[model samples]
Target chain A: MNEERELAINPIVQTSVQHNTQVVSNIRNLTASLFGVAAGTLGLESYPGFIFYLIGTFIVSGLVFVFRAEGKPSEYFHRPLGDLWGGDVFSGLSSFVLTWTLFYGLVRA
Target chain B: MFSSPDRRLQIADSQIRRFTDSQIISMRHKNEANIIPSVYSTHEHTTTTPNSPLPLDITLELLASILLLSTGIVLTSQPLKPIQWSRWSGKMSREGRHGTGRWTREGEEVLSEGDPYAFLGLDGGGEGRRGFFDVRGKRREYAEWVKGEPGSK
Candidate 1:
């Protein structure tokens, strides 16, 4: 109680930005690759290929919030909750596309 | 056939038989040593790490070939990094910016390399109390961590 009072930091909404950022980026990259693999296997075309990844990323974000984060966005994320969950939506698109195209070519051929 | 030395002749014949048996046994050991080396040499090949691009399909399909080629570059290439470096306490003695430069610990802070007390966060100024950059004793900490590697913090 005294330590919290001395620093004047919010105990409820306290988390490290660096740690969250690393986690978010790591999740995005891995899911992007996985989404790409999925897209390729499903034989999804141009727009749908991209859409699949977007949806998958959202699902991953939800999983992170519910299971990994234990439904505590404010505690796990230093930035705005929306920013943490929604900000890096498109960050993994390139990797997803790379894998997606590769898979599609492989499966279709 | 000479009866007086018949025992000596029989002994000589036994000695010859023993010598032949020893020779045959020695030859067999030499052959085994040569054969064993060849058998082991075939299995002494180096093993490769099996992170092959195409693990799903065994057949050489067109899609698999194309995808393998396409992903080979992307998979091997290093991920993109927006910032090359975070620049924590970097020496900026380039051009005309001698002695004075900026150092970043928690955030950016203007610093003179020679100002030991102020640079190292031991200054008795009001900024010390406020912890403007919050880089208290970072210089010494960095110095200790670096082990004199010149700007490792």
Candidate 2:
């Protein structure tokens, strides 16, 4: 059982946690802002703007998982679904809303 | 009350400091150690002040543009470019590690192969194709950090 457990564990390849986090955060902040811009440009109202951000974030998360993690969540992320998909999911919302509101104001103005 | 030598020494030190007056009124002092940017800090210079300029002179539209541009870049950027994967993922025995290996990614095929060990971005073991380093060096760098290498950097 002990040997089996060891075998079940992953290999000794390198994974940069800090770099991964940085990449993720950058993605969140930058994209969230963009989402805000799009929503604003589209003149989306408060609730609609927020909803837009949520949907935008899901798209981004999906892309990050499929591309960055290569659909092997366990290999790249410790928490699998949580780490790859859900964690930091909401981070970009602020940026999205900010931009969305700004654009809405800009366009409406 | 009698003063001990240690007490006298402390008094003398303070007296000297006072006499210099120059020391207290010295030129503007800047804390070099405090200048490093903190990851968590919002970087606003003052929290007490209301309606102040942000740390980066950031405006609403500017902030928005930055975010959208970033998302676009991330989307357009090559897939799996940041990650490094070896052919062997299962339990790698000590001996098996040294054996020849190849680069692999999940979504793509037909390109990765024959990356030399000395430069494959392992624990400084990758030769980097004549001591060169790739953008994917983070994984190897991280591995080295995990091993607690003394100044492997």
Candidate 3:
């Protein structure tokens, strides 16, 4: 297959890939919770709160791209689009909602 | 564990600002409660009424804290290694066990684990190869060491 040939020519290190993925997910999860706190403090409700999360993720992605990936994502991630941008975007949702509700109650109360 | 000093400072600064901002908000809330004594008595009515918008200072502090926290998190995240096999191995070898030239002490420590070729240093291997062995010199040194031993007498 064409994919097999491409892989043969340009081999990937499994360990390095796992490490990079773990690092990205860790950052996403931590920052997602932080965004929840900010959104709750700002008194955002429903749709606006989710939108705030998207924007926050975008900023974190940009920061990782520039600072962590050193402006060349291809070197660090096999599939930069999925791994760096889209990956784990939703994984942080649970934690985000948890903190969002908790802080929303505290700040609004 | 291997965070930069700048990242630590930023996190500390943001936390302090966040604490102060929360304190200010709580104080303002207490003052409001004192002014409108009846409002506190009717908790359900107070809950029903929509809260006022956050003050400019609190909003600014929230934004500042988010920026500082995100920056610190990004900087503190583990540095990614090259994913390509050739590049990854090349980096490992080039950096070596201690990461002599490029990496800092902490970075070297973090990265020195699981080196594929590290075992080459064991037993008469790599640097201890027979080709480069000084047999005469080693024998002489071993003889001197044996002679100097306390039990030898």
Considering every candidate listed, which one attains the maximal TM-score?
A: 3
Query: Once model 1 is optimally superposed onto the true structure by TM-score, how far is the C-alpha of residue A104 displaced, in angstroms?
Result: 0.9
DockQ values of all predictions:
0.03, 0.06, 0.50
Candidate 1 lDDT, tens digit per residue, B2-107?
1233443453344334434345334333333332222222122111322333222221122222232223222322222111111111222222134334557876
Model 3 C-alpha lDDT per residue in residues B16-115, reported as the tens digit of each score: 5554444543433332323122112223323565554444444554566576667667876779989988888888767766632456656653345456
Which model is ahead, 1 or 3, in terms of lDDT? Answer: 3
**Residue pairs in clash, model 3:** none
* Residues B1-153 of candidate 2: C-alpha lDDT, one tens digit per residue: 223446534543443344333432221121111111110122222333324433332233233333333434455443332232433322222223242333346643343323335244564444534545465677888887888777665
- Residue B66's C-alpha lDDT in candidate 3? 72
User: lDDT (0-100) at residue B102 of candidate 3?
Assistant: 56
Task: Please give, as one word, the docking class of candidate 1.
Answer: incorrect
- Predictions ranked by lDDT, top down? 3, 2, 1
Residue pairs in candidate 1 whose N, alpha carbon or C atoms collide under 3 angstroms? A105-B63, A106-B63, A106-B64
Where does candidate 1 stray beyond 4 Å?
A1-15, B1-153
- Candidate 3 residue spans exceeding 4 A from truth: B1-51, B99-111, B114-153
Model 3, position A47, has a per-residue lDDT of: 98
- By DockQ, the best candidate is 3
- What is candidate 3's TM-score against the reference? 0.65
